[model samples]
Target: MHLIHRPDIVASEITPPDVYLDRRRFIGQAAAGAAVLAAGGLLDPRAARAATAPREKLIGVKKSAWTVPEALTPYQDVTTYNNYYEFGTDKADPSENAHTLKTRPWTVRIEGECAKPATFAIEDILKIAPLEERVYRMRCVEAWSMVIPWVGYPLSELLKKVEPTGSAKFVEFSTLADPQTMPGVRGRVLQWPYVEGLRIDEAMHPLTLLTLGVYGEVLPNQNGAPVRLVVPWKYGFKSAKSIVRIRLVDKMPVSAWNRAQPSEYGFFSNVNPEVDHPRWSQAKERRIGEFRKRDTLMFNGYADQVASLYSGMDLRKWF
Candidate 1:
């Protein structure tokens, strides 16, 4: 019998069993602190923002089979260490600047090659399908990773409601880019209303999550409040946040990163250890709270589920 080669796992990177089990308690404590801050009268801008935009517990969050069995990153690390460029370029920028984002009274416009094209309110979108908790490994293009418990339904559930036409071959997603609310938008870091896209089939895949919440509560402003897309197989940048528009079209849409730096960022930003980023190696990644690094997995360890989508195509060429 041949042993399976598991390069992604390392002895030093293995989480202690006790630490894995205690994650729930740690999360509970974080939630308790958040609750107290939400009670009001906080001096800090961040805490005051938290008071106004309190994250409610997402009711009926069913456990999903799609979750991984690894230890989760701490709640604090996941929320604070972010790459939301619309807020700022630094890792801590989003957590500090995104507090000004207004999530309520939001609407997502669904247009293009679909039979039923219409704008849907955030509340109406939530009612479209029951929420499920999927703890997926999030790999960032910047060579960092995290295991987050995201609460959302399969994107197909909402896609089906709009009913795509035969001509719709790709799906394009656009994020909110108000300069007044999002201070970073005033600068020229990236083009306004950040855009991302996926092949029609990938958009309809069960793994493509239309995320609403994280850590069992409504998403914090920094974590892409309102709604976002989570494509587990691709790098984090491919998952557009604070989505405002979704359009189905026949032609491939130019994604924001791809348009910004074609030589660096690709449209199909799949996590492949073989294909390294121009500036860095994609072979290894450091988990947010871990000291040691682990080998990056092909398609972020979801190869069995998503590899077929790229069959017969030269990833190096498309990449």
Candidate 2:
């Protein structure tokens, strides 16, 4: 991603002001050559900036059938249209309001049912698994979509290192909640410290990605910078952003949306055209930056890789 000095930067030249942070962060991190993006299916954490990254970091990254050759969604649309309720309910609120968030000096609190339950700085987290780029389709529960190129390593690599106990049935993740930095947190929109959870097998699936960045740049402040979860097959909301903690447990964990309105949002929010939302049909979705509606695919077209994970389970009931 190209860096610019001011918020009034031309949309054609660099990321928008609200999406991009101050120039000092770019210059300082760039000079150090440590700012790198990670992939999977989540937003990246800028606080987890890399001061030093391997030159050939992308060498191991590979393209899968899941990747479509579609041109990427414009940087402007992707940054402006968002649903980070922590920032605001409107799509543009995050871009317009998330500038004050400080990503540096970040720490991930890892706990619950793991052999290694220790806090990890962003740098140390990236070290556990080599970074790789994955271009995946992001299907939101609202039936909107985008194709974002994310950079990060497989979550399995880290989970393996942490070693979950046999009794662990689910994994829970929480986003940062700093009212001082994020203006929207002060409102009772959904819940403070947005939380999302995944079943143990789902979390361990090879397709699950711990996103560190988007479009090959350290995630912009509005895009859940620092760290987020990115599960391609599930609705975008399942990929919680600005993560601060993770936990392993035996019971199904409650998520923000599901907790607020379980009838509308289910814990196993896998993308399925057949299963319509209570208010709308899920058979089709609006791709961001495009006018035409596209037929929704089951598991966002990742059925081949993750279909078996829910083999005999009743998707409708679980959803």
Candidate 3:
């Protein structure tokens, strides 16, 4: 297997805003360096950014304040790859095919615990909570990763308007399932109407996001079009794409993955290098690039900020 190199960027050595390195030129150098490192097997997996990275870089507005987490940076190297499919199924197809998906007339359904069940247009959501660009690592259960600069807002900000009742213990997320536009659903890889869930606390976590776009552009249909969820700490599947509904529930709603593989897909799918998946060891994952492999970080390197949320619970059993 071809092993990719971890992007080698020191926090202190970040390029200042005043110095603009041509993206085209930088891409060439990075590619050549990755090839050399892969051939020589000189890649240092431990060279990933410090786990407790500065908050400014993770959630900063400008690229200068942003230093991508190692697990996600290599995504830029392989432009043709991504897990999103409302755009199309081929790993490299979404970015190109997603343009065909129209996002207008989209509305999010709010149901379950709130006193008033409401359906609001996508435009109204932007008014509810303004968007912010958050660059985060997206780790997949398949052992591949990406560093995405997402455009979204805190889920909590929107949840507040729904006014989830005291009994609301978990939030259920559902994706749009239109066979006419989303041809992938026609396949049987997963049950129709992809679904995901999160505990009320996790859904409300400061890091959790209700993403609508990426890289300073409206979301490409393949990248979950109208809207999606981004939970950096968990495996990518937990973040449902092309979201259509946000239901406040009292119990753990059945998630698509958990329903498909009860033992393998847990409710709390946080990244844990020590706890191996039944089918594979997640100790390391490949970042999208010219053969760069890096050690997986605990909580996808957000443990310091999120560990306290599950203080007394047994994570191993939860998995």
Best by TM-score: 1
- Please, what is the whole-model Cα lDDT of each candidate in the order they appear? 0.91, 0.81, 0.76
Candidate 2 lDDT by residue in tens digits, 1-319: 6685666765565655753577887676455444233442123332332122212233344454446677788866777788888888988778767777788889888789988887889878767776667888999989899998887777778777778888889999989999998778898887878999999999989889887777666777778887888899999999989888999889999999999999999999999999999999999999988899999999999999999989999999988
Q: Write the per-residue lDDT of candidate 3 for residues 1-319, one digit (tens) a residue.
A: 6498666896667865444357766777567668667766335322221122112222233342333644445323323466665445566555545545567889999999887779989988767765687888888988877788788887999898878899999999988877776666767767878989999999999889888777766665566767889999999989998888989999999998898898998988999888888999999998766386889999998888789988998888987
Comparing candidate 1 with candidate 3, which one achieves the higher lDDT?
Answer: 1
Off by over 4 Å in 1: 1-53
The most accurate candidate by lDDT is 1
Q: Say which prediction, candidate 1 or candidate 3, comes out ahead on TM-score.
A: 1
Report the Cα RMSD per candidate.
Answer: 14.1, 11.0, 12.2
Which pairs in model 1 have colliding backbones?
A: none
Model 3 Cα shift for residue 56 (angstroms)? 26
